[model samples]
Target: MPVPNRPVRGVAAGVPFLAVPPTRRLDQPAPVVVAWHPMDPPRTEAAFAAALPLDGLEAWRIYLGLPLCGSRSPAGGDEELMRLGYEDAVMNLQGPIAVQGAEEFPAALGALRGQLDLGDGPLALVGGSMGSAVVLLVLTEADRADDIAAAVLVSPMAQLRPAVDATGRRYGMTYPWGPASLAVARRLDFVARVDEIVRHGQPAVRLIVGARDDPDGFLAPGQRLVAGLADRYDDPARADLVVVADMAHALAEEPGVEPAPQTAPAAAVDRHAVHWLRRHLGGTAAPGLGAAGEEP
Candidate 1:
């Protein structure tokens, strides 16, 4: 199911609200949608604090919402990422901070669970990039293993090697503790821990990846991940790799930033995102955001 509008604009930018509320009544159970934040997200808590959207849909579809367990990308929460760039010799020393960052993920889950401590419904994780990977990490290591119902992974990372490599180059670290080196060495590689989650996380998983999204949407990020999972694409949606005509990487950039216009295929993928989200969260699936330009 594609989003109604192309590029899927958030009613508000920089603010991602989870639809689930705190006082969830037992008589009326609802699913909780946990959106894993991008690496080092801008505002982890504030993103979930805003009011979620409930219009457009036929029913009053709503669910518990929360950001995923952690962030690692360029969201800027990990102070160490920026701080390390200033000190070449000390950058590797600070690399441990990112590895240790996983510690915060579970805590966030615990907090979300506490907020939704009401009816016994279902919990689903919706994560993008490494945020999806972090969701796996939290669910695998948490006490409430049976709470999750399903998951949605968007362009997830294949391993930690890419992160380490990029971070090392950015910070000018000559030591072996670069993001890639440290990921495997520190045991934080996502691919290394899939088994732990496979046994615990349930229902099913829906993965959305751009056919052309190289690792980190460039090199071999998506490719490496897809290859790693080879025949395990249970419900895969490998969309066209068309870059939204004028869009940038940040689909939700700040004000004055022009939104990229995704082609019909991209629009369908985007709607599929919302469909999965609303269904697991509350709404039912409708026709996808695609039209008769091609295959059905």
Candidate 2:
């Protein structure tokens, strides 16, 4: 059955909220939406701290709400992507950390550091598109390098500058940016930083992509990152890639590899990620809210 398109209701304040069933069983994962609706004001480290229940928190899984700039896919696809039902609780942020003009990348790291805590159990990172970029950025932090247990990156980009270049090439032209863009680019190199962390922390990393995704850019760079990981660890399977046959960017199938049922590709991606996470975290499911989107 097709996942029904549910109407998103916004607060009187205009922030989009994740609508979930009110009553949940103890055995089932609790759903929380940390959505950054387009209209909400920017957030700060203190704001992030206020939103999270980090006060002597026990076991919890943290799901960063990193939304792709242009993709409409709902964050993490509800029950489908979280098939293991391992999360007993979830922390959903409204969106990526707030940054001023040209401050997006670095400030984003600061926001992540303020909100992320390994807690008392295994922590897993999941990101799609730009959100994945944020995940990679957080892992690169020297102090936080060994904290994450595993990561799932979907349609990921390896660096801010190249991603911008890729966007220009795919869309047929480049736009102008101030010095800030260059600064962000120099500081955030996803592939290299991830490789550095993986060499020392050895966190299990999984890269999921659409075979023909952003054909001129996204796919090739992701493949290169995987190859680089193999070279760094000398184990091809340590950081592997899974290309869903008919999936497109953000797990949508508009530009599919082949004509598949509407749900097959996403289901396949979910299965692989959940299974790998299970193995990496020693088969113990962590707690988390089910989904997220760019906290705006």
Q: Candidate 2 on 207-243: residue-level lDDT in tens?
A: 8887867754667777777777777765556687888
What would you estimate as the lDDT of candidate 1? 0.41
Tell me each candidate's TM-score: 0.55, 0.55
- Give me the candidate number with maximum TM-score: 2
Report model 2's TM-score to 2 decimal places.
0.55
For model 2 the local lDDT of residue 233 reads: 68
lDDT of 2 at 131: 54
Q: Backbone clashes in each candidate structure, one number apiece?
A: 20, 8
Q: What does candidate 1's lDDT look like per residue over 1-296, in tens digits?
A: 11122112121222233333422222344455555433322123223112112212222222211222223223563455445544542234323433333345445445544443424446666554455555555555656654666555555544555654545555575445556545443454545654555556343455565454433532355444344343343433421122223322222323211223333433544455545555554442233432322322
